[model samples]
Structure formats: C-alpha cells, structure tokens
Target: MQSKTSSYLANLLQFCIDNKIHKARKILHAYLLRTNQFSNTFLVNRLIELYSKCGHPTSAHLLFDQLSARNIYTYHAVLDAYCKSNDIDNAYEVFAQMPERNSVTWNLIITALSHNGFEKKALENFYLMMMGGFVPTRFTLASVLSACGGVSDVGCGKECHGVAIKLGLEGNFFVGNALLGMYAKCGFVWEAIEIFKGLPEHNEVTFTAMMKGLMETDRIHEAFDMFKLMHRVGISIDSVSLSSVLGVCAKSSFEDFVVVNDNDRNWYNVHGKQIHGLVIKLGFERDLQLNNSLLDMYAKHGDMECAEMLFDNMSEVSVVSWNVMIGGFGQKYSKERALEYMEKMKNHGFEPNEVTYVNLLAACVKSEDVETGRQMFDDMSCPSLSSWNALLSGYSQNEHHKEAVMLFREMQFRNVQPDRTTFAIVLSSCAQMGLLDGGKQVHAALLKDVAYTDLYVASGLIGLYSKCSKIEMAKHVFDELPQYDVACWNSMIAGLSLNSLEAEAFIYFKQMLGKGMLPTEFSFATNAGTTNVSLGCQDQHCEYVKILFYNRYLAK
Candidate 1:
C-alpha cells in the first residue's frame, strides 16, 4: 500500500513540475507533511525541483535548508533553483558546501556562471574540474566553449576544441553547434564554415549562427545566401533567422554594388520586400521583433513610404518601431518630420530613449541647428557615448570647430571617456582650425586607449598632421595602420599631394592600383586638383599627373 501511494505521489509531483502548478504543488507539500511522508529524501528532492521549476526560488531554498537527509540530487535540485533565478552567488555557496559532486554538479555551476556573465570564472572552474580528475561530459565542454566565445578567448576555445576531438565527442550535435558558434563569434568565419559543413545535419540554430557570423564580418551577400540556402534546404526558418536576413539586406543596400536590371532598380530593396512577403506567408507577421526588423530594413534603405505603411500595419508596435521611424526620417534629413514623429510618439505614450535622442541630434546636424541640438542634449539625464558623439559630430560638421574643441575639453573634465568616433571628430576639428598641439594631445589620449590603429581615427590623425604641414608625421600614422582600406590610401595620397609631393602621390596611386584597390572619383580629383594648382609650372611631374588623371577617367 505504501509503495502504491508513493508511486501515485511521484506521478502527481511530475505533473506539477511539467505544468508548473505552483498552487497545487504547495498543497502536495502540505499533504506530505500531514501524512508524515515529508522525510522521504526522493520525494523532498522532487518537491524542491517543482518549486524551482515554478520560479519559487525562496521556497525551494527554504525546503532545501530544512532537509537533513540531503543527497547529491537534492543539492543539484536546489542549485538549479538558484541558477534559474539568476542567484549565482547562492548557487556557488551550495556548490562549495557539497560533500561530493558529480559531473552534473560541475556542469550546473559552470553553465550557471557562464550564462550569468561570469565567463572567466566559468573557465577557471572547468580547469578545476579537470584537475579534480573528472572527465568532462559533452555538456561540460559546450558550457566552457560558450564561455570562451563570451570572453573572445579563442586560444582557450581552440584548446577546448582539441579536448572535444580527443574525447571523440566533437561530432555530438550539441558540441558541434557550440563549436560552430564559438568559432563564428571569435571572427573566424572560415573556421565556422568548416565546422558547419562537417555537421551531418543542419538546423535553424546552426544556420543562424553562420549567417550572423557572416554579417558581423561584413559578408552581407554571403549572409543572405546562407538564409536562402536555409529556406531551400527545407529547414524551418524561425523569426530570429528571418530578422538576421533582414539586417543583412539593410546593410547590403548600402554596398556599392549596382543591384539593378536594365531599368536600374535596386535589387537589394526588392529582396528586402520579398523577405517581408515571406514573413507574412509563413504566418510570422504577428511576431513583433520580426516586424521591427522589417521596418528597420525599409527605413535604412530610405523608403519612408514602405516603412510608414508597415508601421501602421503592425498590430503591436514597440518603442523600437518608433525609434526606427525617427531614425529613418533623420537619415533623409527631414528634421521637421522627425520632430513631428517625436510628438506623435509622446502622444502614443512612448518616451524618447538614448537612440532616439542621437537620431534627433543627427537631424539637427543636417540643418546646422546647433542651438536646438544643444538644448535637446542638455535635457538628457545621462547621455551615452553615442549621444556625445552625435552632438560633437554636429559641431564639427557645422564648422563650429572652436566650440567643438571646448566640448571635448568639457567631456574630458567630466572624465567621460571618448571612443573612436569622438577622437575622430575632435581631430577633424583640430585639423580644420590648425590646432596642431590639440591634435597631438588627442593623439596621445588615443594611444593610451590603444585605438591608434583604428582606420577612422588614423585617417583623422593623417589629415591633422598633413594640414599642419607635418608630412612625416602623417606618413608615420599611415604606416602604423595594421591594414589599409581604400579610404586610408586615399587620405595618404591626398596628404602627399597637399604637401606638393606629386611624384610620391603618383607612386602611391600606382601601388593602390597594383593592389587591386579601385580609386574613387575623390581620389582622382584630390591628386589632380592639388597637382593642377601647380599646372602653370609645366613641370614633367605636372604633365605626368594630368595625363594620368585623364587616362584613368577616359579608361573608365
């Protein structure tokens, strides 16, 4: 009779766990106490698990504390309760007090730590687990790999990958996906691709990771292709994957590729609309985030009509929806429209956030409305780095160079750290005003932050040095760049030409061409324009530059 009763109670507890019936679970706990069955270790563990699963962390912990006949499973149940509630500190306490721990115990704490942003500590625990002579399970390796990716510790990730291979668990489904994600997050897209291809089966998650990896690395076309392949392969494309594809489309619209037919229509825009159509067909139109992505993609492409139409059709609009509209109009330099939308957003009960303010400031920049921009910026309670950059950029763009330098000093006085954008904008202002000393100070700060190699910041330094007639300093900045983009090369060419080094400018241009870097019209114009100023001299180098410019333009 007792055996049958215990079996029935076990079934009832499982049902409570599965359906998360907290109230009913409480009644069962009371009945167990009334019937003197509360002392049963297995039943108590199940009760603890039920409370944890129901998100009653305090109740779970209280019951765990009262249980004197605790086993490993009991400890595991309570630890999971804390982990699920994001009470990692308490979870660690329980882990430390455990008399014995198995592979599952180690995995629980490691996963808890990793998910709660204690990634480095999680890796340390993994090593400790190894030193304790416990062979890691697939789940253990997956958690450690996730931590590696979190911290961008690719060296440790590689070591974990080797362990996976040694344990012959690399082919396990969970481990394989984790490996792919780690490689992708670490910016090794090719390595991710190799792992992706080797996987025996593809799922939505696997494909999504690969697409995001491609997107992050600026491989927009390839990311979109992966989305298409996911659809073609008959994998169920979730809202996340669809949203990611829309982001790729938004970025691709800005690429220099001529997405056109004979009529010169943008195929990228057409592709974005097609994705929207697919979202509707798949019955995912009600997914709020996916719709937001659709709206954002349309906005980024400057199709305000489509964006507004989609916005009106969205049944459940979020703050992101309004932010996208404001930013969209801002991009088109429609300051009045952007302000009007802000009013409408307030009427609809959405308060402006940092991104909204940044977009508003950008609109103000378009009209050189620095006074109004200043008023809006002052209203922000705690401005973010982006907010600072927006107003600083506005000041620089509107030729408020002196005021811009003043703002930079004020920002420093407040101990507000400047990022690459802030440094670049301030440097541009210093260059325009010929404040070589101020530029050098900004350069010193940039070096302290180890951001001297950034392409945008480096270009600003080059411009400042060149404008100050420090051609050698400009050349040194260019040489220090880890890799040269076309913009950097153009900056170098223009700096040389500005200093009347026409011969050297021509040589760099030739080298640019040799490296297969296509020169834009600005590149040709800068070199030709600077050289043309000396055209009256009739020097051989002047003749060579003129001939070179005409030949290049004519060749195109």
Candidate 2:
C-alpha cells in the first residue's frame, strides 16, 4: 500500500506534468517540505523537467542546485533546461562539469549546439563523443545529420547514411525523416527521393521537406507530381504543404490553356480553387497564414473577384490580408479602391507598412494621380529609401521630369540616403529633361556607391548619358559592367539608336548575338528605327536586316 505522503507527491508531479500546478505550486512546495519529499531524487528531477517545459528554466536550475546529492538524471534535466532557455554557454558549462557522460548527454549538447547555429562545433562534439566510446543513437544521428545538412556537406551526410545502414536505423521513422531533410537541403535531390521512397512511413513533415527541396532546385513539375501522389496516398495535408504547392502552381506556365482564352502567366486559379476547398473542408479557413496564401493565389491568378470575396468573408484578418487587397487593386489600376482599403486597414487598428505605401503609390502612378502620391509621401512618419524611390518612380513614370528632379533634391535634403532604385529613376528624369549638369552630378554620386553597378542602375546611367548626347560616357559605363545580361545589351543598343549611330548599333547587335543572348521583342523594337538612319545602314547590313525581320516575325 502507498503511503499518503507518497500518493500526494505522485499527484503533485502529475499536476506539474499536465501544466495545472501554477496556482497550487506554493501549497505543493509547502506539502513537499512537510513530507520530506525533497530528499527524493526522482521527485527533484521530475520537478526540474516540469519547470523547464513550463518555461521556468531559472526555477529548474535553482531546484537542481538545491539537491544535496544529484544523480545523472538531475544533471540531464538541468542541462536540458539551460538548452531550452537558449543559454548555450550555460548548458556547455553544466555539460563539462558532469562527472560521467552518456549517449543522451552527448546527443543533448550536439543538438543544442546545432540549434544555436554552431553546426561546426556540433560536428566536432559528435566526433569527440565517438572517440569517447559512446555509441550514437537514432537521436544522435538525427542531430549530426542536421549539422551536416546545415553546412551542405554531402560527403559527411553520405558517411552518416552509411552509419545509419550499419546501425539498422535506415527505416527508423525519425532517422529516415532527418536523412531525407539532410539530403534534400544539400541539393542531392535523387538521394533524397530514394530515402523518401524507402521510408516505412511518411508524415506531413516528410512530404513538405521533399516538396520544398524540389522547389528550391527548380524542379517544380516534379514537386507537383509528388504532391498529387501524397493526395492519392491519403496523407494529411497542412498549411505548409499547401503553401508550397500553391507557389509552384503560380509559377507554372499555361501553354495548354492559351487557346482557351487564358493568357495570364499564372493560370493556376483552377488548382487554387481545389486547394481552397480542401482548406475549408479541413476547417483551416481561419488560419491566418493559410488565408494569406489563398489570397495571393487568387490575386496572382487574375481572380480578384474571388480575392475580394475571401477578404470580405474573413472574420479574423491580419495586416497581410489588407496588403493583399491593396496590392491587387494596384495591379488592376483601381486607385480608389486601394485608397479606400488603406483607410479601412487603419480603422481596423493596423498601421500601414512600407508595402502598403508601395502599392498605394504604384496605383497612384498608374492613374496619374500625383497629388495623392505626394500626400501619401507626406503621410509617412519616417520615410525610408523605398518610399522616396516610390515617389520618384511615380514622377518619372508620369514624365514629370522637373518635379522628379525637385523631389530628388528634397530626398538629398532629408538625408534619406538614396539607394539603387533612386539613382535609376532620378537619372531617367534627368535624361528626359535634358538636364546634363544634374545628370553629371547624379553620375558622380553614383560612382561612390558600389551598388550602382547593379544591372538596372547601370543601364539607366548608360541610357541617360546617351540621351544627353554624351555617347562616350555611355560606353564608359557599359565597359564597367562585370557581366552583362539581355537587358544590359538592350540598353546599349537603345542608346546607339537614340544617338543615330546606326553603324555602332548594328556592330553592338552582332556582338550581343555572338554572346548567345536571345534578343527580346523590346530589343527589335529599339533597333527597328536604325534602318532609317543617315549612315546608309540599310545598304551596309541588308542581309542582317532580313534576318532581323525573320526573328521579329517569329517573336510576334
């Protein structure tokens, strides 16, 4: 028969495990003192574990210190408490002071180090643990595999897999899942697939890892195929898997639907509807992040009607929900609706973030509503570089070159520290207004910023110089690019055509083709005027002219 004191101690420990002892804690401590249960090592260790899980690591450590004769379990509980608190240094201190070490102790420290971004250190400890003759368990292998994956060390991961096979843990669910995640993240897609296939059981986490890995490596179609397989296998779908699938669907092309009057690049609206139904059936419609994904899918799929309906139906909405609506309206050039929602979002007690202002300003630009854009700019409590660039973009897009230059000066006065986009838009404004002196000042400032060599900014500088009739400077900027893309080549060609240097344009065109860059439609459009130049370009490049026409027709 159990004694009354022992029964009470058992009940107290159960209360702690169930997280129902917060108010009764003082009484329980008083009773423990009265019953002399503090002398029980098992009771003390259980209290430490309980307090740590309850987010009271300090209390757990105090309890551990109060023990007159601590056992291995007491030390393990305290170390775990410190690790849970993210106090890795303290955990290491406790770990080093342990008189005897076991496999569990090594695994705990290795996992804690890995979790805190010390993957190299975690690997070192794993090696040391083996040298000390402690055999690695499934938990130990999982942690080490994660460390290997963190550093993208495929060789180490493969060696770990060989060890798993020797230890007969290849099909162990937890170990198999960890190995799957390891190989997938390390870009060993085929090996990951094989592990995933050989798994004795599959979980939602397993599928999500495989899908994310496939998506990361640009194998989108295969990911979708795997997703369908999961559905066939009746594996439960969750928000993460749904989100990944929706993202891939958005990027997929719709060549098969082009003949059916579906021209949107993202024709995934069909698949989106099916997934939305699943979310609803699973009673996850109230999930904030899942709702956000559904909203983005609808907006990008060109189904604003569905997006607006979903927004209206949401009883519990977040700021991202409102941002999605604003962005969708901006996409449709509906400035009024976007502006209305800006107020609606504020009324709902959410302040507009940088993305809100970006969408609002973009809508204003499309509608040529410069006054609203200026108002929005003034409304920002602390305008960032993105805000200033947004206004500058609006001015440049509307051909308000003089106003844009004025805004640029104001940006300098406010010390906002213009970024790459700022230089691009401001240089464009200078080119339009033929402000050669201002363009030169902007160019001088750009020379000091290393980020200006980014493709867009460099291209804008080249075009600006050509428009100001400074072709030499344009070439100088062009020569400085470390690597050139199709847009970089197109900008150079456009500069030549603008300056009536048809001969130079054709020579650069040949150079671009020699670099194996397929010319875009914009490329042909810019060079279309070169044949009418005064250089007798038509007589000089008659054969190439015909080839251009053939390609242009194909582009059409």
Candidate 3:
C-alpha cells in the first residue's frame, strides 16, 4: 500500500511536469522533513533530473550527494546535468568513476568533449565506442561530424563520412546536413555541392550550406545564382542566408581589379549602387553589418559622396562603419574629408580603434601633412606597427627620407618591435637616401628581431640595396628570400634595371613570365626602355621612353 510520503512525492513529480517547478521543489522539501521513508533512490533521481531539466545543475548535484545509494542512472543523470551546465571537467570526473557505463553514458561524454573544444578527444571516444561493439546512432555521428567541421579536418571528416555510409546513416537528414557542412567548411566545395544536389528534399539549411561554400571558394556568381534558386523554389531565406549572400555582394562590389590599359579600368559603381538599392529595398539598410558593407562598397568604388550619405544616414553606427568611411575616403585620396570624419567620429562618441588610427595616418601621408601626422602619432596612447608604417611610408613618398629613417630609429629606441611593413617603409626610405649604414643597421635589427623574413621585407631590402648602388647586396638578399611573389620578382627586376643591370633584369623578367607572373605596366615600361638603351639603339630607346612617360602621364 502507498504511504502518505509516496503520495506527496507523486504530487511533487506531477507539479514539476506541469511547470510548477518551484512549488514542486517546495513540496519535496516539506515531505523530506515530514517523512523519513521518502529518501529513496527513485525519488532522489527524479528530483535531480527535474532540477537538471529546469537549468539548475547545482541543485541537481546537491540532491545527488544526499542520496544514500548511487546507481548508473544516478551517475548518468548528474553527468548529463554537468554537461548541460557546461561543467565538462566535473562531468569527465564523474564518467571516470562510473564502474558501469552504457552507450548513453559514452554518448554523453563524447558530446561534452565535442562542445568543450576537445574535438580530437571526442573522435577518439567515438572510436572507442565502436571498438567496444556499440552501434553508432545518428546523435553520435552528428556530434562527431560537427567536431570534424569545427577543426576543418578534411581527412578525419572523410573517414567519418565513410563510417556513416557503412552504418547506413548517410541518408539521414541530420547526418547528411552535418556532412555537407563539414565538407563545405573543409574547402571541398565540389564535394559539398554534389552532396547538396543529391539531397532528395533540400531544406533551408541545405541551401545555406551550398551558398556559403560557393562564397568561401570565391564563386560569387554561383552563390548569387543559388540565392535566386532558393527564392524560385519557395524556400524562405533566413537572416543567416541573406547575410551570407549580402557579404558576397559587398565584397565583389568593392574589389578593384587592375587592368593594363586605361580604357579597361571598369569602375565598381554600378554594382555597388545596385547592391545598395537591394539593401534598401530589403530593409537591411538599418542592419549594422549591411550598413558597414555599403559604406565599404562606396568607399572602395571612389564614390565618397555615396559613402558619406550612407554613413550619415545610419541610425546606429558601429566602430567598423566609421573605420570603413574613413578608410574609403583615404583610399580615394580625399585626405581632408578622411581626417574630418575621424575627428567627427570622436565627437560622436566612437573611440578610434587601431584600424581608425591606421587609416588616419595613411590619409596624413597621402596629403604629405607630416606635422599633422607627427602630432597624431605622438598623441596615440599606444600606436601599433601599422600606424608607424603608414607615417613612415608617407614620409618616404614625400621625399622626407631622412625623417622617415629617423622615425625608424625612434621606434627602435621606444622598443616597438618593427614588423615586415615597418621594415619595408624604413628600407625604402634608406634606399631613397642612400643610407647604407642605416640600412645595414635595420638588417641587423631584423636578424635580431626574427620577424623580417617575409617576402615584402626581402623585396624592400633588395630595392634598398639597388638604390644604394649595391647590386651585389641586392642579389644576395633576393637569393635568401624563402619564397618570391610577383611583387618580390618585380622589385628585384626593377632594382636590377635601376642599377643598370639590363641583361640581368631581362633574364629575371623572363623567369617571372615563365612562372606565370604577369608584369605590371610600370615594370614593362621601365624594363623595356632600360633594355633598349643598354642595347645601343638610342632612337628606339628614346621612342620607347617617350611612350612610357606618356603612358604614366595618362594613367595619372
């Protein structure tokens, strides 16, 4: 026969199910004091599960400790409670002591490991589960696949995919979606696309995965097309999907590709304006990210007016929005407007980040406003290397080579370690001034600091040596570079030509072309004229020189 304590406990369990958790807990506490027979294993586990489900793991743990006898269910309930509470360490400790473990127990531990950034450990446990002769379920496979995706481990992802196929879980929607996401994020774009196409019924998640994969691979046209396909098929695009496609549009709308001829220099305004219209029509203009993207699109396209309009109209501006506007005008050579906006940004209560300072310094450099640049530099609470590089490059471009070199020395005195850009600007200035001693000091500092091995720094060193009329030193630096990019090769070739090593420049140019690296217009013009003059054809050389000079004039 049921006692009063049993009836009261049953009522408390019913109260918990009916969402009266506080009342249920109160009644349970009253019954515990009213009767000693209520302290049973079943009653305690039920209460623990209730507390765990209600998002109170500490209460669940306290109840578990009060139990006189512990079972596998008791351990599992508390371990799951710890997992839900994001206390994986305590969960693992409990798992370590459970003498009797089941498949559910293993799954709980694996999930805890996966969610806590222990992807490799999670995969290892999944393998352990399989070797222990337990058949993997959809939940187990989904969790492991998610871990693979998080780490972008393609080989491990492929192995998991094979396991899923063998277990006949590949066709399951949740498992299939996880596989698609894993392959997409791992850069297997084609494989992800194939899987997406093979789905018998594609959901919103399926479309989003394919679109994101295409965008990541820089297939922007295909991503946009897939977005249209989603609309045509009546699949509603969520905020994530819309945001992803808009990001692609924003990127493509601002990216300026260099063309060899003046006529081929296509402006980005049309695409940028279209995207802006679409953003407005879609009512995403108020979104901070979309507004920031629109500002970037206009700034990059040299539409300062549109950028300013968008920036001013933004109801809620982020630091990024201000940075993009300042940077956009800076890129378009509107130095005054850039600086003004930066000042206004501060007035509007936006504290300038590192990016803001970098953009402002770049504008000061473009305008050759050294005094203003110096003032800004000195005013910085803590300037980064990028800010220093901008000022130095500006000084170099304005023919203030000595000042730029002096600034490098000052930076060294301040213990601000120079990065590759720092080395590039200072070396460029040293080359312009023929400061062999200063250049050598910088080289020594680079060796000591151990961050100057990048190709840009090596290229700058070569240019410095060539300008200082140390062709042998330039060649030595070029030889020591770990890898040569197009810019590096161009700098070396130009350096050789500038120092009157026309034959060597021609040879390097040929090597660069053979490696499928296209020469810039300046490189071609400079090298062709130099080679012609060196070959003793004065009139032909002069003719090519005239054409080169005229081309430069027109480019400006």
**Winner by TM-score:** 1
* lDDT of each candidate versus the true structure: 0.88, 0.83, 0.79
Q: Model 1, 187: alpha-carbon shift in Å?
A: 3.2
Q: Candidate 1, which segments miss by more than 4 Å at Cα?
A: 1-21, 35-42, 68-72, 87-102, 113-134, 144-152, 254-268, 478-486, 503-556
> 477-503, model 2: which lDDT tens digit per residue?
999899898888888988888888877
lDDT of 3 by residue, 47-147 (tens): 77777777777878887787869898889888888998889888888888888888899889888898899998898888888888887787788888888
Candidates ranked by TM-score:
1, 2, 3
C-alpha RMSD (angstroms) for model 1: 4.0
Write model 1 residue lDDT over 1-556, tens digit each, in one string.
Answer: 9888888998899888988888887799998999888788899899999999989888998999899999999999999999989899999999999999989899999999998999999999999999998889999998899899899899999999999999999888888989998998899999999999999898998999899889888888898889989999999988989999988888874452225556856344778888999999999999999999998998888889899998988899888889999999989889899999999999999988888888898888877788889899999888888988889998998899998999999899988989988999999999999999999999989888867899988999999999999999999999878888888888898988889887677678778878888788788777666556644453755676667667768776
Q: In model 2, which runs have C-alpha deviations exceeding 4 angstroms?
A: 1-49, 57-226, 229-236, 249-268, 281-283, 346-354, 447-450, 531-542, 548-556
Better of 1 and 2 by lDDT: 1
Estimate the lDDT of model 1: 0.88
Model 3 TM-score relative to the real fold: 0.65
